[model samples]
Target chain A: MSPLLLILIFIVSTVVGYMIIKNVPSLLHTPLMSGMNALSGITVLGALTATAFALGTGSKILGYIAIVLAMINVAGGFTVTSKMLKMFKHKEVDNK
Target chain B: MSDILFYLLCGLLSVLVLVGISMMSKVEKAVKGNFLSTIAMAGAILLTLVYYDIISVTSLWIFMAIGLILGVIWGFKIKMIEMPQVVALLNGFGGIASALAATVIMIEPEQQNQDQLMFILVTASLALVVGVVTFTGSMIAAGKLQKVISQKPVIWKNHQWITGISLVLSILSIVMVAIDTKFLPISIIIGWVMGGFFGVAFTIRVGGADMPITISLLNSLSGVAGSIAGMASNNPLTVAIGGIVGASGLLLTQIMCRSMNRHLLDILLGKTTSTGHSKGVAVEASTVVTASDSEEDIVSDLASIIKSAKRVIIVPGYGMALAQAQHLVSQLSDSLEQNGALLDFAIHPVAGRMPGHMNVLLAEANISYEKLREMDDINPEFPNCDLAIVIGANDVINPAANTAEGTPIYGMPVLDVDKAKHIVICNFDLKPGYAGVDNPLYKMRNVTMKLGDAKDTVKELIDMLR
Candidate 1:
């Protein structure tokens, strides 16, 4: 597929995935987010695969760029997920 | 092309925002459960072409069908205590998917050329390690939560050695990635297993009182996994948002543990496995006065109390949720207003299982948000108020947190309900709560203990005022 087409596919799918996950109600949120979050790790795999292909195919610059981006993405997910978990820790200090 | 997608997406997303806002008024947590959120997500994605495409549609539909069947079966068969395990297991599935993504990329590095082998190696390794930890550790946590396995700490004198090894291995995995070495996979896998083992041992060994914290830690782990996955995928938004959540979660966990006088190592080492913390010496039962004699008597008594009180603070608890008594609670509040009692609801941060659990329940009852008071705002007034009505709350109002020496819940701030001239508590029974310790409030000379369902108890009180 052409780069344009690949970009469109990526954009569309990301948007779709975002929309689906966003709509989950509070009741289902904990589980849904927990589950979907794990699945989101696939982005790393995608980045890895894309990076290797790019570098091996002589697109060295693009490969390095993708790797850098992918690392940030992975780190961010862990950050946010951990933050959300903080909400559940030992019991909120209600400061009552 | 971009404009059309953008407009369509924006328009669709508005609906989700509106729906979320609509749900804000509900007091019952059940209103905001995952089921509704997932549905809204589906609607948003489909309309905006996020996951409405053919492949996504097919996959989603398959999951939906399977989910529907399982939900139906589980709802009818599972007990309340069993629900946590079920949720935990589901969480594991997500963890596994993330790990699998890492494996797939590792086995086939299509992005190696562009990102350099280093980036792919690093991102893939991080994803694999976190994903595996989330999956296996969550399963172990689910087992303990469900009581399918013992909730005791797995102690060996050399527990420190194991933890040290795991920490070293995890750090080494990161270093391996930094160096762009092929050993990245092997090191990360070992780290993954060790981390997961710690997570499991940590969860299983902690006693029941820390269920609230256990739930939070697991939640944070899942977010970290997402962030790691996002890195491998080169996604900025995921990294930004996910990192915020993960870091904050770890920070919150530390704060909570510290507030409870616990060290992070002890909590993670599963030192709390001994139920000894809550094994309070039984106070010989004291019989003072029954807060409620009969339904008719309570009604008569409630009318008088309503007539006498000026400002009343209401404290809600898990019993309120179990009774699904938001509506009745609202009705009672209204009746109190008519009787000239100024009423406000006090919300403790951890009043219910999840954050804002009580708030959600009160919102459902159509209790105005303005009437709700968080712990900080409402605590000061407790001593001065004519009456403090506690509905199904246990620990949040426990005086032990403030007074008892070496007590498990000591030093945590609690509502000084005992300071009130009159205090009334309603619950189904006198059974010890999740803390598994007898409440001293029930023995207080001034506080009146009313045992019954919150719904029925509140109704009787309302009728008394009328």
Candidate 2:
């Protein structure tokens, strides 16, 4: 994708996000924030590529650290969200 | 042909990911919605990486596998109560990753066409600044929230001027990069340093009471940085996700600001000052200071009152989290229900360190969301209630937010527990909450302070009730 097209998509998604998040009840805001925090960990994709294609030892080391950090964000974030969401069960249904 | 199919799949999954997050709140099966959306998002991200050939190298698999294992292990090892800290740290990691990715792009003198050079520099600079800021700021925030550092707002003279100058310099450095100046590498490093300073400078000055908003803002910043990074890398799907994360984070930040009755500017600029309680005296006429009350007397009194109350409301705070007492509270609530007293929970929006922190805790303890009423929904019902049991909560129940003016937390919306006919407070000490203001609600004639560990106090009450 071209940078221009990517920018357009970014703008559209920002608007879409604004509209969708407007209605989130305060009760769920914390989890929603965390869930999104996890989603933003998508930067792991960048880290993976950057590390793989790193030109030198310095960039390679930095890229490796970035990959580890981003991966932590992604894996930990999703697990935590799901765990928290799992606890949000209705009264009648005893999932635990 | 496969490329076309892959692009279509990415587009569809991107939409599903956004739709999945939005529907999480309304759906009956929120977990299922969250699950599907999370998976779709992961799928889309992975596919995009593969399609771009970013993850094609067989050697990269080892690093990827190791990183995933470490992350999953850390994630599962953490307790649910530490969700805020985990989220904060994760955001920090995202920020740092974006910064490092941008760093790699900036340092390498690779394929850059003249037409796109300016755009790339702009995006790279943005990713660097925002990412660095979020990284350092979130680390401080997570540490403070976890109480590894003092949660008090750290203020020093001449701080505001320092932050302003640093931010301006950072922006100037970014402009230098965009202008294709001689000091491009030097300018990039300056941007990162200044951005890091801004993050710490901004966060360290905010009091613990304002952490939720601060954390949310930083989280949003990480998203914005990721988006910028995506734009720089020419990844459309990543840009979209970044956009979604950033926008939603800002919206939540706005809501948090409103709940505190403070403007976003006030929070960001450190305009709000903590109204420290100089002396532990009751300022409100309605509040009559009671010499520190004994625990046994209050618990027994609470037992008798619970026996007679027709409706009871349990208001929880971070103290409940502190004492690790949600399960005990749930058990007590069940016993209360068994004893013919109707019970409901009133949760302040910013009750815990994180958003919805109390809700998750309560739900974990098997309390139904139906029984947990939001402040707006439950405040009016307090007047008719027999008793309001506040566990380790100070600021949220402080009537000063409602009736008092000129106090730092004056305009903040607090639980109307004072409206109840009787109130029982379970806390360890007479110490003020994160806001550092003595709670005027404590001195109310109807309020009883049961000073003890929340879990022990509540457990004893349960035994007595049984």
Candidate 3:
């Protein structure tokens, strides 16, 4: 990939992100942070590719560690945010 | 043809992710959309790897299985109280992932033939520094928020110099790696290790009071690191998601800083001193004194106040969560409503250690969202409120923010409970809040201090009202 194209992708996504995020309410900040953390977990793609093509033991080990860490972010981020949003769902009031 | 299809899929999935994030705050059943987008992201990653022939089907499946099991277990095991720290740790994990990926990619010998090798190396170096710093800094943040370590700012007079020097050293090592200079391996190690040290140094000086800003900022840093890592790997899928996360986290950090009325630089440099120390001294200098009322007297007095009051507002804080009193507080509100008094809840943005924390607890007790009012919306109603009951909340309801100067939280916005005809403050002790400043609201003439465990006191109040 050309450096120019990658920079273009980076710049465009950033502008798009700013527009979307500015609408989120203060009440959802924690969930929003966690959700973004999950998205950052996309490093798992690079980590997986790195491990599969690793030329040496050092690269292989680092790749494996990276995969594990990224998975934790991916899985934990989505799960936590989901649990939190569930609390926001209305519940029937028990007058007891 | 297959390669084209794979790239197309990745592009489509990236769009889905953007759409999911935008819908998350707007729609009901957002979790479902989030999961669908996550699946699409995972699919894009897998297909891209296959197109590159980096991993065969069997190996990819094995890695996916392992990753899934670990993720599910970690997610389910986290309790409600641990959510904030767990989120912090997740952010740290993302940072470590990017740093590790950048390191592995940098050590490869194939970069010599790449036309954009210089740009890739620079991006990799950026990832290495940012990722290392975020990883270590977030771990420290989680520790402080969870009380695994001291919640106070651990600062020395030379703290700024120490952080500045370490950061410089880290940058120099990264420069060596980026420029293909001598001692490559040693420089890489030094760069990341010093970056890690800088992370710890940057976080330790921030007390718990400013943790929301710290956590959000670290989240943003991890996103920036991930984006750089994406560029280093020449993967657009990672780049897109990383860019979105980076931008969103940055915006959220800005919003948090604006609400706190502090600059991003001031927070990072540890320049904003919260009168945490001076407030302790002010405790002695404070001339106004009042006798702490006993529980029995408080119950009797509160009962009469409730009887006469037509409108009441409740402001709950961390202490309420600590005592697990949301259920009782809910019942008390119901009792007030039954007595023909209109009851409302005022929720502070930073209340209960995280944003919307109080809301979750109250929602658990089946408190309607309609009855919950934000600080700005509820402030105007205080003037007409017959009684304002502050349960286990200190700093948010502290009158000092408005009336006192030179205090750490002096300019910060607070709930104007002072404007009410009567105020009842319930707390376990007279200690100042996380900011460690004296609360002048306790000394006000219309205020009554009811000291006890928040749950038991609220239950006692319920009994008295009955």
Candidate 4:
């Protein structure tokens, strides 16, 4: 990937993401934040690549730790967000 | 995978993530939206393994499994009230992950052309600095939220000077590493140490009330860090998803800042939540109400007020969460409805420790989402309300926001609780809230202050109706 192309992707994604997230009501802001928090852990891709291409034991260990931490962020963030969203039930739903 | 095919897949996955986020705007579809995002993430991870030819890496799978187990356990176990700190801690993990990945990139020998190597080195160093700062800053924020550290703003002597110097040094180190590969080892150390100091200095002076903004900002930084790390590694998928997270966090930060009428720069410079501290003391002395009636008389008066009310609005704040009084609040709302009163909850955007946190707490207590109204939607209804019940809330309902010029909360939007015909307050004490601005609403004749732990006071109110 060229640097110019990568920068373009970042800009396009950010603008589109902002427009989409703007529609989320304040009622769901907490879940939105946590869900976004999970997406930030997409850095796990970088970690995996770095670990795979690592030349030294030290670099490999660091990559492993990064992978683990990013996975925790992704898994935990999504799970907690789902839990919170589940609690937002309507009166009719509660009655049922 | 060929480069063309890989880029196409990245684009497809990014769209899926965006569709998932758009679905979050509606309550009904939000759960499925989260699941979709989870699937997209899993797909992205699997794609990385195959594209990079690392599918057979045993150590990677073991580490990821360990993380998955821990994450699931913690996610299921955390109470709603602890969401702020837990989110902060998770943000730290994401930050450190990016930092570590950047570090590995910096350490591994590069086979790229000279220009490409320079770009990669500079971006990697930048990512490491941002990632480490986000990690340390989030840990401090989590500590403050959990009360492991003091919630009061910690202002060291010449705090701004320290923060400035550390930030400058960190940037300089990044530049040096980019200019010369020989400075890599020393530059990495300087980046980590200076970045850590800068993070702590930046966060230590942010008082508890400013946490919503701080957490949002740190969340944004973590995403930016991940995006930059992706740039360093030339991973388009990481860059795209990380950018989306960054944008989402920035939007939330903007909303939180607007709701509080605070400037992001003022918060970054640690100028908030401290201006009214001395002024608060003077206001408190003159405004203390001396109850002329006995305790029973007060209770009876409140009970009578509740009995006659036909429409009610409940305002809940962080103190309500602290008192674990949501259940009692839910009960009170139920009892009020039984008396034929139309009831709704007014949620300030900055209420509780994080954005929309009060709603989650209320939801946990079995209050239906339909009854929760945002400040703008509910403010107009207050004037028509027969009574306003404020539970462990102060600044959000403080009438001073409208009249008290030069105060920290001046011009900040607040729930118009005073517009209601009658008001009842259940708070811990008469002390000023986190922003240190004394509430003028407590002095109004139409308002009755029930000073005690919100749990006990709300339970008592429930008992009175029975």
Candidate 5:
């Protein structure tokens, strides 16, 4: 694909993604966020793959940076999400 | 030109992926939501790289699929009960990812040009401050929620200076870390610790009544941090939408605080935490009056109550939050509707756990949002109402704010239910509301306190009307 085509693809995807999220009603935000926070954990893999690839191809600088960030994004996201779920702690919820 | 486009693509994908995951799990098992978002994010990143000729598709697939499976399992295990911790985790990761990105660029010797280096450095720094604060502060919040750390006020004698000095030091460290590495990391670490310290101090000191606002405040902070991540990545859409969440959440928290007459400084300083020992107390399961005569008891009293009444209003509070009695309240409203009586909801801004909490609860039971009235909107109507049924509500209905001269919740907005001709409070007890103050609304001459478990009480009242 041409460079312009790739950039266009990126832009279109981003817009499509943004519209999907932006349209949700305000009431759904917390639950949405709660769900997203858990999912954000996967961004670690993205960061890692991007970084590792960036590194593996001799772009050592961007590569290392990506790895460090990816790890933090992955690990940190999960930890925060685990903690978020604690606030709703109740006995009834537990039996579930 | 390509770098900018790449950054923009990455940014959009990040938000889109997160949003995609959010929708997939609405209120289903929360873990499922997190798993979906995580997998989507991981996939988006891999796809972006392959599109850019940065990475082969094979490795990206292998790595993320493993990640996808692990993340999904983890997401499923995390109960909704752990949501606050999850929020803290998100804030921490946003901060940490950026900080690490900055660290990578700073230590990089392979800089072909200064522009990329500068981009990385600034973004990393942004990440460091936000990440550290979020990471540490969220830990403190989690600790408080988990009871690992005391949630009681940590008011030192010199709290203002302590909070102030830490904040100033944090600002100073930003410049210091950028200029030299010797103390920057330590400073950043300290700043992170200070953020948590202050957050806990701020949160623990605030009364339990203000927990919803505290949750909202932290939520806003998390949103701001996410926007910063977007900016560091040169993503405008992330910054824009994140800013919306951050700003709106804070506004909601502020409105909730104001309606309660709570001062911002007081909440931060932990002033009210110790003073309101009466908060969170379960009201005794007793009533000043009971209707055992069933239909005859309600029917006999209904005619007189409805006959002399000019209007009738219903007050819903935390008890309603616990009982989930909104539909029942609507039923009661329908019964009164037959008597040619007017019925309205007396909604105090801070009536329940979260702002608009009662309204939200009622909306779930399919109550019309328009039928719910705000304190300012419906206070004038209380005087004309022949009956004000106080259902599981306390502080907002208390007349002491207007008549008792001095109450902790003085000047806070409330329904003038005391002004009505007949007041019936269906509460478990008169112990106090979350504020720990005696409600003179109970003592009104026309007030007849009907006590029982809220659900059963309302059900009995409904049976009588039938």
Candidate 6:
């Protein structure tokens, strides 16, 4: 991808993301933040590509660690967010 | 995959992620929204493997599986009160991942045209700096939140000067990498060392009460790091999703800053809660007045007030989380409702250690989401309510924010608890709160101050109602 195209994609995504996130109420801000935190782990894509193309053993090992860390970020963040969201129950539900 | 087809798939996945985020605005659809986002992420991962022709990599799967297992366990084990630290730690993981990926790219640059090589190298260097900083800064923030490190702001001698020099050096190293390929290895070392030092220096001076803003800003930086890593590797999917996350974090940071009536730059420069006021005199004076009124008499008076009141608003702060009093608080609210009082919880945006953190704690105690109200929505109703019950909360309800000029909390919006006909304060002490400004509300005749552990005090209220 060209540098200009990459910059355009980032700008467009950021603007659209901001507009969409503005509608979420303060009530769900914690879950909203944690969920976005998980999305930041999308860097796993870069890590995977780097690991695949690595020429040296040291660089490959670094890429492997990156992949693991990013995956943990993705999995841990989404799981915790779901757990929190589950607790936000309405009054009419069966009470704990 | 052809370039055209690959880019089209990236666009499609980005829209799916956006739609998922939009669904998060409503409570009912939020769980499904999170699931949709997870699916989009899975799709992105699969797309990357196939497009890059790395589908048969056995070790990658092994590493990812290990991470998944650990993440699931940690996510399940974490209590709601510990959510702030957990989020901070996970953000650090994301940051370091980007930094490592950027490092790998820097070590062995892909053979490309001269123009493309320069762009990639520069973007990779930038990514490494941002990622390392976010990683170290978030670890410090997490340590502070968990009380593993001192929560007090640490001001080293000439702290600002050291922070400035480190920042400049990190930037210079990035510039060196851009100028010549030969300087790559040495510049990378300086970038890592200086970036890490800068993160610690910048974060250590921020006090505990200011953690919400700091954590939110670091969250934004982590996302920006990931997006920049995407730029280094030329991955559109990573760039787009990372950009969205970055924007979301920035929005949350803006909300937290506005709610606290603070400037982001002030926080970055370490101008935290301490305003250098002489708070000892004010605390000593208030303790004497409270001593004259016996604890039993105050409890009985508060019980009667609670029974008689028709409308009540409860204000909860970080102290409530610290005392683990959410359950007792929920019980008290139930008892008040049994006496035929209409109840609502007034939650400040910056309450607890993070944005909306108080709500999660309350939710964990089985308090229905319907009963919680934001500051703006519930502020007007305080005057009409017959009683205001403040549980371990101080600065959010402090009337000093309105009348005390030159204080840190001056002009900051607070709940109008003073407007209620009667008030009950259950806090840890008579001292001023995190803002270090005396609360004039404690001295009002209509207000009864009960200084003790909130769990015991709130349980006493519940027992009196029984």
Candidate 1 chain B weakest ten by summed lDDT: B21-30
Candidate 5 per-residue C-alpha lDDT over B343-420 given as tens digits, one digit per residue, 9 for 90 to 100:
778778776544445554565555554567767778887767788888998887776666544456777777788788
- The deviation in Å at residue B87 for candidate 6 is 0.8
Q: Judged by DockQ cut-offs, is candidate 5 incorrect, acceptable, medium or high?
A: incorrect
Which regions of candidate 1 fall more than 4 Å away from where they truly are? Answer: A1-96, B1-94, B140-195, B251-263, B273-280, B285-303, B322-331, B428-440, B452-456
Cα lDDT tens digits for candidate 4, B313-411: 999988899999999899999999998889999999999888889989999899999899999999999989999999988888888889988888889
Looking at model 1, residue A3 earns an lDDT score of 28
What is the lDDT, from 0 to 100, of the residue B266 in candidate 4?
A: 89
Q: Is candidate 3 or candidate 6 better by lDDT?
A: 6
Give fnat for candidate 2.
Answer: 0.71
lDDT of 1 by residue, A1-96 (tens): 122332343344334434433333333233333333323322333333333334233333333333333333223322332233223211112211
Off by more than 4 A, model 3? A92-96, B1-7, B27-29, B55-57, B111-113, B181-183, B276-298
Q: lDDT by residue for model 3 over B22-117, one digit each (tens)?
A: 777653646776787678767766676677786564655566567667887888787766667877888899998999988887787373327777
**Residue B278, model 3: Cα distance from true site in angstroms:** 5.1
- Candidate no. 5 TM-score: 0.65
Residue B114 miss distance in model 4 (angstroms): 5.8
Model 2 quality (TM-score) = 0.92
**Error of model 4, residue B222, in angstroms:** 0.6
Q: Stretches of candidate 2 above 4 Å error?
A: A1-4, A51-54, B1-7, B112-114, B276-301, B436-438
Alpha-carbon shift of residue B313 in model 1 (angstroms): 1.6
Every candidate's lDDT: 0.54, 0.80, 0.79, 0.89, 0.55, 0.89
* Model 1 TM-score, all chains together: 0.64
RMSD of 5: 8.7
Candidate 3's docking class is medium
